[model samples]
Target chain A: MRRSALVVDDSRVVRKAARRMLEGFGFSVREAEDGEQALIACRAEALPNVVLLDWNMPVMDGITFLRAARAEFGADRPPIVLCTTESEFSRIVEALQAGAQEYIMKPFDATILGGKLAQIGLLDAAEVPA
Target chain B: MSGSSPDTFAAIAGLVKARAGIVLTPDKGYMLDTRLAAILRRGNFASLAALAQALRDPRGEPLVRDVVEALTTNESSFFRDGKPFEHVKRILPALHAARPAGARLRIWSAACSTGQEAYSLALLLADQLPALAGRQVDILGTDLSREVVERAREGVFSQFEVQRGLPVQMLVKHFIQEGGKWRIKPALRAMCRFEERNLLGEHRGLGGFDLIFCRNVLIYFDTPTKAKVLAALAAQLAPDGALYLGGAETVLGLTDRLVPLPGERGVYGPAPALARSA
Candidate 1:
């Protein structure tokens, strides 16, 4: 079974970089520019196994999307990870309270991404091929 | 001098093995290169060869110690493996109940690099074990690296370190932000102490512990060293205590001093035979 991910970030560079990394991890990667598109994509297509969301966006924000998604699809399915440059401790707590499974600071590489995924049970740290 | 020449690698590897009981093979040459680069830069050594030569000198005792410490420093994170922590949480109350009235509980985080494992135990007690209120609980974190022990003593962590394995809610609850870094709250900090102690050396001064966490450390040792360390750990462990090894480590061929605790992963209890004999 192929794992799937929906990356919701306004920056095409970030989405592309994340896609490349996720694809390398054997995940089928999808992209949306903002939270609204990501939510629509979730409803229209099959829900992704995980979501990598950015906080600041044009149409919708990560926290809003997280709340709406949790309410609609249920709280625990398709683990949502907030991948943003928000280093504020309060923001992290807020995202977690709003149902984000994990939080990542931006400027992340494959190692950091893989570690966060492992924390959320998306990947096994020991089994990841070097 | 700094290139990965076989001689330099051999010299450094041999020193580490002799001093720290850590076996380093050719495959870990890259680790030596990466870890030793800082020492070279700090000492202004021209290369790894220069560092290796310096380590050979009788006056290079400090350099040799630093090299060993650098190689032996283990990567750690809070609640590193979720399962072991969960298992500890579930069993702790029962263990507490078994204790005599008002008896203090002590936990050891052996080979505790950067103190995350020790502090994680403190957070567990602070967050979930309200039953332990008014009871004295001590968590001791020991490692071979003086630098890491000092860092652990400070209870300060960079943003990157805190973000690694800690959950957002727990981070908010337990840490205070200080100039873009996080410091473990004073109350929680008081629950644990940090010391520079070698796992391969004497542990007689450290008394019995109700729970011991020596995770991800024995993998670096050879079979003999592992057996010795396990025996030492068993001696310090209380009769009803639990020992947590790394997820990948096992005691099957190592020693008869410990046997796997039933229904738990990566957890062990003193062997029944050893217990009976003792």
Candidate 2:
């Protein structure tokens, strides 16, 4: 099945690039500029299968959004993949504990991203890793 | 309750029920106080009475709507439960078999908060219905709130949104990492549309749907409103079509036009009478 994803970040360039990459892999993409916008967008559409979220943003940050969304969406919440530059093991554990399903560091290779996507089950095995 | 009078409580309760269809009891005064206290503070009112006075003013109609909207929770997620999609899997094959060649297959998600439920359905169809891959399949989602509808159209979600109920495999297949968020690809999104629609109002323009999912929304309505919404849904459903409600909801006592589909507990089929009538 073709999967749909919601990419939340503050940077337009990042949103565009990610959109391109996902589309290249045959997945559909949606964008949000910040956490509040992302929360509103998430509520506005049919829920995407996965969410690519940034840690920091204006208005509402990633962690706060995660807590609220987890409480609101309950067991049906999407599998969250944290896309951030924070690589410290403590930070990763904090994110995982805060409800992130997976973590992808910044400046990641497209192939590595694809591998991570595949590892998470958003892509099929035959598809080349990002 | 300190300075609040019973008369003020009655008036506020009446307004809530009339405007938002929320049936508040006298015992819920504390809830009323808590929910509206912020409004009072924002308006610079000293007490709930002052807030109620403003609410009763014709000028405060918008404020009333805002209050109700604020109080009405918009809690939702994508792929809420795993089983509904499983049922969708079974129904798709049957729907394809029942449909004529090249005919469009349509699904409407009423009260599609954000777009999770609708997209979840789209993913299921795309994955399971290969014959339908290139066919004309319209997955339309509608909600009463304009803000929610606008967000649904944008289709952006956070890490938390992605983690709710989605499987990791679906995530990898469907999403791309951008910054710290994941955005749905356009192709998957292309199959669906979102609109602002109030189920209690007229649905003349929305064409007949092969499957209508009004999950988890009816619990907010009173029995009469539920009956009205169900009747409207029955009118929009095609013969042999199905309806899915929240696990806690049922049409058994509320309406005769929807009979529980065998083997699927929450799934209901249109009553024979409605089928023949339609």
Candidate 3:
């Protein structure tokens, strides 16, 4: 099955970039404007297989959404990868502690994004690592 | 090099592979033609045929050196991949555990063009491993291009170059804003040294390293060349050293002399037998 992804970021540009990269890697991608909406999307009948989250967002930030989704989705919660700028590195450790599986900094290209997805095992090991 | 015969081009391509291990296929003839033209003009040769024949002369070292430099890929960037740097940060504690007390730490950025990646490490080590401030840390960047090696040695980057992959804080902290370029602070530049080298040839007795970043250079080599290069790297790596390949490159099919670290993308360690013997 093609894995599904949810990209939650206040910026449409980042969400679109994430969506394009995720979709190219064989994920059915959905976008949410903020953590609050991402939680709503997670509760849908078909949950995403992974989430490409942004650390900062309006209404609620990525860490809050990660905690809420982990509480509500429990075991069904897909791997969350926090995306942020270089300055927000401290929050990367925080996000990982809060159940995020991995992370990628901003200004990423398709190759870097694919490598991160492969590291999380959301993509095939053989195809993606190369 | 312009309007050269196919035989001359083939001979030049074969010579490049033997000299530098950079395989240029017949499809790359136009690229060779374009790059080699400058060498001819610089040498004031009438045609590439004269240059090619001179390459056969016993005193061809300088001419061959120029050819290799022109063929070497000097393209690189700062923090080429964020993941590997993150992986290094995660592994630092482990690396510390593996090393003895107060031992020097060394990192080799193989084929490091213009020293961006090596200096990037210097900056990272300065920030991430503050405790190592007392310990000796050396970052060596090597390339085949004399022009780029000189640039790396100078430790200067233009505004556009510094903006790529370098954060604002790092830009301000580690660099002096010259007229339109950023010069790496002397302290940072002191941690690094640049040399001209051919990966296929001897390293001139360069010693073992704790971490070797030979990223993105293997894609150009043929299978046999890749295997030879990997084996050579394994020999120079400390028993506990890590070898980093490009995201698109791996040791799985190329050679078993190195094995990929489990759960670590683009990181590998010397094979168990190799590590044990070392």
Candidate 4:
């Protein structure tokens, strides 16, 4: 029962950082540079258990991917969490309305990321290796 | 301290246990260097050795209090561990039905660091139990630290704090966003009150509670202290009321006054034998 994640962001640095953290939390992670690539990954491979999405990316942004993913794959699976610099309440409300399961502000460390994963029930089976 | 000896750690541990009743095992000596670094800078003690040496005097109660406060970890989040809250939501209807008409259902959040546990309950009652309106519920959040109590009373949380363990929808519904922060709305704030009260200090003045949450606080105490605190908390619970402990904690050997509430982990009620005797 290996849990997998899809990390979608324009910056390789952020994807690498999130990949390292998610890997530490026992998630097998895959990277997608933008939303179109993420959708291709979703369609070609099995849906990930969770998606760490970045907003404002070039070519299909996160919200577009979210809506499209919901329309095609369904809204509930592969629980999407919006991870970006967007701290605006309106943006958060919009993300949740668009079908994101949770929201994480940028500059989050391992603890914040881990807590959000746990909150969404993604970390239930994957215990962080001591 | 890199230069300090184990005796310095031993001395500080002794002082903390004597003053605050918190057991600091030798393995946790590493925590002193980190947790006390700020106090060392503020007090200009040069090193933990100097602080431990200064604590040798009997009249250093204020400094001892500061050290104790710093050493006590305040790690908490909204709806932490999640299960106890689910159980609370499930049992609330039956508990309310058992009460007399219009009687207030009181809940005590002991050691309510930064007030998340108490405020989480308030949010749950407001969101889940619409039939029981505002005035019918009373949530009391108490802690040993005055600083945290004041912070809890303010009902303000940083973005980082609000993000942890809080559902996105609840955050939108119950909190108002300030610049870079969120404040629990007045409606939710009005349902709860925060106080600086110690579990070991006194309890006669605090009235009985229909549900008590003394989670994660008792783990820092030694066995005898754990038994004592359990007895005292049990004293404040109504006969049929529920008491929730941390998932890692139990009353197995601590006290006979509390027995596990059926079908839930870390939940306890007054021992039927003890309740009947009373």
User: Per-residue lDDT for A14 in model 2?
Assistant: 79
**Tens-digit lDDT string for candidate 2 (B193-264):** 999877778886887999999988788778998888888898898877889898788886787778889889
| TM-score for each model | 0.88, 0.65, 0.67, 0.91
Give a tens-digit lDDT track for model 2, residues A38-91: 778878987778888888888888877777778777743777778876745456
Q: After aligning candidate 4 to the native by TM-score, how far in Å is the CA of A110 from where it should be?
A: 4.3
B75-142 per-residue lDDT for model 3 (tens digits): 66666666788777776667777788888788999998899999989988889766554677889998
Residue B263, model 4: Cα distance from true site in angstroms: 2.5
Cand. 2: chain B TM-score: 0.88
TM-score of chain A of each: 0.96, 0.91, 0.89, 0.94
Instruction: Write the number of the candidate with greater DockQ, choosing between 2 and 4.
Output: 4
> What DockQ would you assign to candidate 2?
0.03
**Ten residues in sequence with the least summed lDDT for candidate 4 chain B:** B127-136
> How far off is residue B110 in model 3, in Å?
0.9
Query: TM for chain B in all models?
Result: 0.94, 0.88, 0.92, 0.93
lDDT of 4 by residue, B1-278 (tens): 24457899888888777655789988787889888888899889988889988887789878887888888878888888878998898889888888888789999999998999999999999976676543389999998877788899999999888877787788999999999999999989999999988788779689999999999888899999899899999989998899999978999888889999888899999998755477
Across A1-130, the per-residue lDDT of candidate 1 in tens digits comes to 9999999999999999999999988899999999999999999988899999999999899888999999999987679999998888788889888889888888877766776787778887653432
Please say which candidate is ahead in TM-score: 2 or 3.
3
